[model samples]
Target: MELPPGWSALLEDYVAHLDAERGLSPHTVRAYRGDLVELARHCGVGPAEVTLPALRSWLSAMTDAGAASSTVQRRVACVRGFFGWARREGLVAEDPAARLTAPRRRRHLPRVPSRADVDLSLASVSARLSEGDNPLVHRDLALVEVLYSSGLRVSEACSLRLRDVDRERRALTVLGKGGKERTVPLGVPALRALDAWLHRRPEVAGPRSPETVFLGARGGAMDPRVARRVVHAATAGAGRGAETGPHGLRHAMATHLIDGGADLRSVQEMLGHSSVATTQIYTHVTSERLRQAFRQAHPRA
Candidate 1:
């Protein structure tokens, strides 16, 4: 859909603001741009020209078109953010989207892999590593171990450098969302696997390669996609049919930690979550487990 000529420039400015001032990732900025562009098309107006009625109608149309609740919520956020920026910049006399409300997002529990499944998967990966001195095998085992141990996001894991690991302390200096830095402790198994990979790292690391801890097949820094593939393959090899990724390992780590009686604040800090509320989701998982156990072991009748 073609937007007014001025709207294009406005969108470019908004995206730049998100990138520069907001420090949003490229992927996130692109999502905001896409959603705002759709709104501009639906309203057939420029940023300043959009009315509250038009904003409401656009949202209604999106919901009526069968958009998921999360999709609608994101779109609403995009509209609100764009107009909020515009209002502050004097592009609009008033924020039309100020009153816009989206459907409350459904809180679906994160899918966590069972401890047995994770154990089996790690056993399978370890068995492969025991077969030979393959550098890639060592790297894969370390990657999965670190992911499960630290609950590092795939991007965070891929972005790690040689200096990020503290060999003596068994800890990692992780840069997480919003460029926040946190130090997370590594388990003994993760430390051992990581040490093994470091020993064999030079065989594949090219002279031109950066000091990235995890290297790609060609010796460059490992891409997040490759890291995800390593996790997926390892999980599948354990005979688990469910789709699992690095983030699933993160979810599993948090749940397992909470189940082991770890405090919410400690888990929140470990996972680098800015808010403790985000870490509270693991309590729900624990509660659900108790519910299942009660149903199976106790019968009032």
Candidate 2:
């Protein structure tokens, strides 16, 4: 269904607001635009004409169409935010999505690699680098080490700049979701890897390369997809049940921190999570691991 012209204009304005005023990341702005566009198309209504029933019906259709609960939940948040902004901007007389709700999302525990397994993987990567001085291998090793050490989201890692690294402090200034910036400390291993990569970076760096800390083969800013592939390949043979990727490495770092008795608030700060509740999931992962170990090694029921 084609969205009305008014609806299109309203969506564009809201997108601009999200980007320029709210300082949301491009990915987040795109997601908000997608959700609102789908809502407009589904309801055949402009922003001002949208009603609560229309909002609910849109969400109901998404559920009926087999969207994941988490996806629907995200859309619900998108709609509520858009409508709230619209109402404040006088684009609508009232907010229709204010009362909207979606199904609760299932809290699935993240897969976390053991420290030993992760060490084995990094050692393997180091072995590959020993075969010859490959810049790509250097970059990959540094990328994985940074992710595992700092618990940075893939986007934040890719967005990192040369200025973000403070070698003396052993910390990186990371820009995370919603443009929130925080300092995450690097482990000694990560700092070593990063030092190695920086030494080789000049060989691959193009003339116009940005100040991004990590770079692609062509010297452009590091692509998250490339970073993901690098991580997956590095960890592919780590021999854990769950396949590890950049995000899995992130989960692993957080889980390891919690396992080592780092406070939830500190992990939350390190991870740049907006809420301690988000950081608490690592505690769940650690607890489940203990349960599995107890079941395996206990002598009596």
Lowest-sum lDDT 10-residue window in model 2? 234-243
Q: State every prediction's TM-score relative to the real structure.
A: 0.94, 0.95
Model 2: per-residue lDDT, tens digit, 1-301? Answer: 6886588788888999998998998888888898888888888867888888988888888888999999999999999999999899988898988888779899988776788889988998999987987898999999999999999888888889999999999999998888788999999999999999999999989889999999998999999998888899888876557649988888888888888989999999999988998888888888988999999999873
Q: Which portions of model 2 show Cα errors greater than 4 Å?
A: 299-301
Q: Count clashing pairs, candidate 2.
A: 0
Top TM-score hit: 2
- The positional error of residue 265 in candidate 2, measured at the CA in angstroms, is 0.6
Q: Can you write out model 1's per-residue Cα lDDT over 1-301, one digit (the tens) per residue?
A: 5896569998999998998887876778888898888888888877778999998898899889999999998888888989998999998899998998989888767767888888988998999976887899999999999999999999999999899999788899998876788999999999999999999999999889989899999999999999999999887743244338898899889999999989999999999988898788889988988988988888861
TM-score of 2: 0.95
Task: In candidate 2, list every pair of residues with a backbone clash.
Answer: none
